[model samples]
Target: MPQPTGPATAPRAPATASSPPSAPPPFPPQSGPPPQEALAPRAPVPPAVSEATRLLCVGVHHDRAFREAVLDELYVHEERFPAPSVGIDAGRVLSHAVRARNHEVGWAGGIVGLWLLGLIVSGGLLALALLGSVGLVVARWIRGSGSADTGVGLVRRAVAFYVRWLSRLYLVYLFFAVVLAALFLGGGTFSGGSGFGPGLSDPLGFARLAAFLTLLVLAGIVACVALRRGQFARVVSEELSPSRFPHAQSDPAETTAGPRLSHLRTRLRAEQHQPLVMYEEDWPFRGFGTPFHTWSLAIELRPRGEAAPVPLDNGEILRRIVPLVEALRVPSPRKDPAAAAAVIDRLRELRLDECVFLPADGLEWRNGAPYAPDAFAAHRAAALEEGGEARRHFLRIRVGGWDEELVVTVFVRVHTQGGMLMAEFAPHVLTPVRRGYRLAEREARRHRALSWPGHIAWALVHTPSSFGDSVRTLGGWLWGELRRAFAGYAGAPAEGPSAAVRELGTDEDLSLFQEMDLDRYLKTIQDRVAGGVRTALREAGWATDEFDQKIIHVANGGVYIDSAKDSAIGIGNDNKISHTPGGKGGGKK
Candidate 1:
C-alpha cells in the first residue's frame, strides 16, 4: 500500500485558552481572518491543526455529501496529489466522519426502541409502521439507492431517511394517543386498568401532562446544544486534535478500524507526497482548478544592432524567473537590526515548485513507487528542455493565505521554440470555504439563552431527514467496503475537484480583500516571470521592445483573451497562431 502524502510535519494540539503555549510559525497567518470567517469572534486561531480540524468537523458534523465523497475516494481509488497539510488528511477526516456516523446511526436506531414502546402501548396500524420500518430500512441499507452516483441516488436516499423518521414520529404520536386514551380504563396501563391512583383517569389531563414532559426533555437537549456550546461544530473541530484523536501521528484505520473500508491510508496518500498542487478541468487548464485570469504573449526574438542572436531556451527562461518568484517568500528585516523574529509578520503561505504535469493515464501506479529525487529532478529538467502539449512544464507559485481558506496560484509556462519566445501567465484563486462551514466557529462563541428555542426548532426541522442521512451514510460505507474487498475500487471513475474538501465550499468569485491579495500575488509573480523573459532576451542579444510592449498591454488589461478561441496572440509580425485542439499549432508570420 502507498503511504500517506502531505507535509511531513506531525500535527499537534491547538493552543487553546486552557493551555495557550504557541510555537512560532514559519510566517504569520495574515493580517486578520478571511471576510466570511471574520465575524466568528474566535480566539487567535491555532495554526494547521485548528483549521484542519474545523475543515474535518464540517464534513463530520454538517455535510453528508462531503463524507460520502471523501470516503468513496479513500476506499475506492488513489489520490491525484499529496495532501497540502498534515492535519487535513483524507484518512483522518474519514475516521472522524466514521466515528460521527456511527454515533448518528446508533441514535437513528432508537426508532426501533420507539416502535417497541408503541407496540407495548398500542399495536394498531401505527405499530405496524414502526415494526415494518425496520425491515424497510434494512432492505434500503442493502440495496443502497444506487449509491455510486451523486444525482438521483442521493435524493432517493435522503427521501428514505425522512420516511423512516416520519414513521417513528407517527408511532410516537400513536403512543401518545394510546396513553391519553387510558382515562376510561380501570387499573392496568396497557389494559386500561387503574394501576396509578392519580394519573390517566382523564384523556385531556393525560394529554396535558404528556405534552409537558416531552417538551421538557426536548428543551433541555436543544438548550444544552445551543448554550453550553460544546455540541456545536467548532468543538468537534477542536476535539479532532491529535491529543484527542491520535490518528494524526498514526494510521487512521486503527482509530476506527473496520473491514468495511479497505486501504484507508494508502488511498489517502495517493502515492505522491511532495505537495504538488492538484487542479480540475473547470476551465482552460485541465488540472489547474478554475482559471481566474490568463494572458499569453508571443514575440519574435530578433538580433539587436545586426549582431548574431545567441541561443535562448525555455529551460533558461523558466529557470531565471523561478528564484525571482521565490524571493518573495523572504521577509524583509525590520528597521531595528536587533529585532530578529525569524518569522514573517504577514502573508506567510508561500510555495514554489518546478515540475511536469503528466496526463492522467501517464501517472506511475506501481505499489510503493519509490521517491527517486534524482530521477524526478531529471524528469522535470527534461520537461523544461523539451515541452509537449501532453507533457507540460510549469513554474507554479502558490500563496495559501488566510488559514488556507483563500489560495492564489500562478502557473508560469515559457516556450522558446521556432524563434518565438512565448509565455503564458495564468492566475487562479480558491475562495473561502462555504459560509455555512464557518458557522461552527461562531456557534462556539455564542451563549444566547433566548436562542435555545430557535435552535430546537432548527433541530426539529432537520429531524425528518435524520434516518436517511445516517442510514445512507452507513449503507454507503458498507457497500463501498464490500466493493473494495471484492470487486476492487482502484479503477473507479475519477472525480476530480468534487472529492477535494478544501475546494468543496469555495465560491466562484473572490471577496474584496481576497481579490486584492490575489491580484497582488499574480502581478508580483507575473512581473518576475516577465522580467526573466526580458533578461534572457538581453543576454541573447535579442531586441526586447516587442516583448515589453506586449507586457504593458497585458498589465493594462488591453488584451482580450476571451475574444479568441483556440488561438495564440503574437506581436512583431502582427500575425496570429491558430491552435486547434488535439491538432498542431499552425500560423504564418
Candidate 2:
C-alpha cells in the first residue's frame, strides 16, 4: 500500500566508476499507468492476412498453371470411379445352339418320313440308325487328334472349304441337267417317240412321267441351293431356344471378387453432394476413314468482379472468329514439290475452279438464311426451351486449295446469362480421290448384288466371309450417313465423298488415292486451324482451355478418353503428344 502511493517507481541506481552515467529517466518512465501505446487498446491489429484470395484469383485467362491445375482436378475426379465391364460369349453359345437345332430338325424330318412310309417299327429303327450315323460323323469331325494340330486341322478345314464350293458347283450342274432334259424330252416328243420310258407303248403316260421327273429335279435343285447358302444356318443361329442354351455361366473368381453394387451405391452416395461437370467431346468434321487431327479450345466466362460482360450476339462472335479462320492456311507446298504438283494436276483434271484448292488464303462467309419463327417454335416444341434469352447464328466458310476444298461451318449461340457464348467451329475438308466416281459405281453395283436374295444365298453358302464383310461395310456406311445428318444439323459440315469428285474420278484413280497417306496432309491443315483459333481467343482477352478436347475416331465410332493417363488431354495432330517444339499439342490449352 505504501509503495502504491508513489506508483511503484523504480529506485535510482548509484553511478559506477567504470560505467558512464545513465540519462535521466523520462517523466512517465516505468511507473504509474502503462504507456499510451501499451494501454490504449493497441490499435486493433489487422487480422492475419491470407494468400487464398491471391491463389484463387489466378484465373485461367492468362495463367497456364491454373489451366493445368483445373484439368488435373477434372481428370482425377473422373478416374476415381471404375467403369463397368460387359462380357459376352456370343460365338461359343451361338455355335452350340445351331448344332443342337440342326439335330432337332433332322430328328423331326426322320419322324415325318417314317409316318409317311407307314412302317412304324422298322422305319423308326432306320431313322434311329440314320441319326446315330450322322452323330458319329459329327463326333469324328470334332474329335481329330490333337497331335495333328496343324496338319489334320488344315485338311479338315480344306474339306469344309471344298464342300462349300462343291455345293455352289452343284447349282451349275442342276442348271445343265434341266437344259438337257428339256432338249431331249421336247425333241423326242415332237419326233413321236416316248420321251423317257418304254418306246411308244403309252406315249402320253411316258411324257407325263418325264414332265413329273423334271419338276421333281427342279425342286430338288432349288432346295439344294437354299441349303448350301447357309440360310438354314443363319435362321438356326438366330432363333436359338433359351431353354436349350441358357446364358453363359459366370466365372467363380469374378463372382467372388468383382465390385459389389453396394460399394458403388456407397461411393455414389458419398459423391452426390459434390459438384460434377459432364459433357461429351465430338470428333471434328472429317470424311470416313480420314484421320481425326483437330483439337478445340473451350472457354467459360462468368461475371467479373461486380460487373457483367456485355452480352455478345452471333454476328459479334462471327466477326471475332473470322480472322482466326483466315489465319489457318494450309502449309506451303514448297516443302514437297512433287506431292504438290501431283495434287495440282489431279485438281486440274477434275476441272475444279482455281479458288477451290487447298492452302486457301481466306474463307468466303455465307450467312445461312434464318429459319421462320414458326419453324423454330415447332422444333422447340418437343424439347425444353432455354430459359435465358438466346439466339443462334450460322456462318459457312468455304476455303479451297491444294486439290481440296474445306467447308467450315461456325455455329455461335449466345446467351444473356453471364454473357455466355458458345462457338462451335466445324471444318470439313473434301479431297479428290483419283477414281472416286468409279469406286462409288463399283460399290453401288456390289451393294445391289448383295441385296438380291439369290446372291445373298450364294454368298452365305459358298463365301460366308465375303457375305459378312459386305454386310459390315454397308451397315457402316448407313451408320456414318446417319451420324453425318445429325451432326450437320448441329452445325457440323456434312461428310462423305464429294459429289463433284465422285462424278468425275475413275476407279483406278480412287484406288490410288485410297492408298495415299492423306492423313499427313489433313493433319497439317488441322493443326494450323486449331492454333489460329487459340491465338485469336487469347489475344481477345478470352481464356482458352481444352478440357473438352477429347480424342475420338469418327470412323471407329465414339470418343476414347483414357482416364489413367489422361490421353485425351494433350492429343495433337498425330492423335498424341508432339515432342517437337512448335508442334501441335492439344491446341495449347
The estimated TM-scores of all candidates read: 0.66, 0.29
Top TM-score hit: 1
Model 2 RMSD in angstroms: 34.7
Candidate that scores best on lDDT: 1
Total residue pair clashes for candidate 1: 11
Output the lDDT of residue 326, model 1: 64
lDDT of 2 by residue, 1-589 (tens): 0111112234455555665666443342121222222212111111011111111111211122232332222111222211100011112211222232333344334333332232233223223223323333344445443434577777776665555455445545544554454345422333355354433334543443444444443343334333433333332222222111222133111123224323433342332211111101121111111112333333465333454445444334445555544433322346654443222211111110000001101212111211244543443332112322222223333322221211111222222234444433333223222232223333433544454576546543432122222233344434544654553333432121111111111011122332232333333334433454444445455544531242123223223322211122112324432121111111111
Q: lDDT scores for all predictions?
A: 0.51, 0.29
Q: Scored by Cα lDDT, where does model 2 land?
A: 0.29
* CA deviation > 4 Å runs, candidate 2: 1-163, 166-296, 300-314, 323-589
In candidate 1, how many Å is residue 63 off? 0.8
